[model samples]
Target: MTRIFPRPLTAAFAATAALSLAACAYNETLGRNQFLIVDDAALTQQSDAAWAEALRTQPTSRDAAANERVRRVGGRIVQAAGLTNRSWDYAVFVSNSPNAFVLPSGKIGVTTGLLGLVRNDDQLAAVLGHEVGHVVARHAAERYSTTALSSVAISGVQSVAGDYAKAAGAIGGLGAQLGVLLPFSRNHELEADRLGVDYMQRAGYRPSESIALWRIMAGQRQGSTPEFASTHPSDASRIAALEQYIASQGWS
Candidate 1:
């Protein structure tokens, strides 16, 4: 039996496949290939919207000192990353969780708890550098491209099925979050960590303090998800890797 795809559907599939193939490009900075179907303009627009939504929905800190500190440190990291071409904006969220994130659109959010946790400027630079590394490495675009390609592939499967099912059903809520709106893969995290230390050291910050910051975070007895289950490396493994990378670079 011969099954024929509709002309429009066949065209769509061809386009999708072409996009997938064309998206694989080598990133010189990351020393790897990245799947980036979406262009920077689209990602930046989405990031801008996401940053605005975060600011409107989340409780942000009004502390002058905290805001200034994040901005000051973030500025140095961005410069070190050679990403000063974009206008970077910083915001401190009023959260107890020690967390921070950077959008590709040059928006950074740091929690108040993170500000309080860091013992010095170097440690703060470490955190900011990690976030900046994500932007530099273009992890968000890669994740979005991978998820979009998966969704397209699943849609092709649906076209052949007797009854169409939502792609969301094929990929559950958790999978969707992981593919779209969550932390990066463990590999991405490690790459970010390495790039972060590079930027930190280049910016005249102590590369070793980055490891210390992670140690302090590991010691915090907080009820949270484990690293094994999350898209982040274990604290121990992360520290070890950072130490090795620092030693290889001879940055002390």
Candidate 2:
């Protein structure tokens, strides 16, 4: 007996093969030519929408003094970093996660947990500056571009594979590709640390406070590790890098 697959299937497979090759070629060329793909506008739009959704869903603190402190520090860093032209906003959330993040649109969020860990305003500035560094350097968009490329590649592979299950499995294999993206993240973190220190110094905050701040953070994770560990550089590694950057900048 003989079996025949539909012509549509064959055409789809051909299309998939072409797309996969195109994606590979684009990635190779773009990777060599540029480090980032998406522009600032698109990043800002996506980030703004996400930030708005997060703020809407999460209950935030209304403490006048606490909010003032966040705004004060955030404002200083923004000005020092020459981000005055950017649409920036800062908020302190009432969470105990010891975390902070800055959106591509300059929306900044710092958890109450992080505030408790910080000893002074300067330390807070250091943290905020680092988060802002991620934004200024457009790391998130870079990640997004890579992710889009991967999605396209996977779609192409699925088209050729013809078996949805096999396609899903192939897509699942993207963890390694994602892991390869980490070096870029690490580089961004180091750059942020350097930029944060510079911003703090210019804002009249002692850059040395960053060292103390990270030390305190490292000490705080005595028993359990936080979820951010997966995405963020390890505490020891980050602190060491920050120290080296500080020393190089002659911050002492």
Best by lDDT: 1
Off by over 4 Å in 1: 1-17, 161-184, 221-228
Model 1 scores worst on lDDT over the 10 consecutive residues at 160-169
Top candidate (TM-score): 1
> Could you list the CA RMSD of all candidates, in the order they appear?
3.7, 6.0
**Candidate 2: residue 36 Cα off by (Å):** 3.0
Q: After superposition, how far is residue 140 of candidate 2 from its true place, in Å?
A: 1.8
The RMSD (Cα, Å) of candidate 1 is: 3.7
Model 2 regions lying over 4 Å from their true place? 1-34, 162-172, 175-178, 222-229
Instruction: Give per-candidate clash totals.
Output: 0, 0
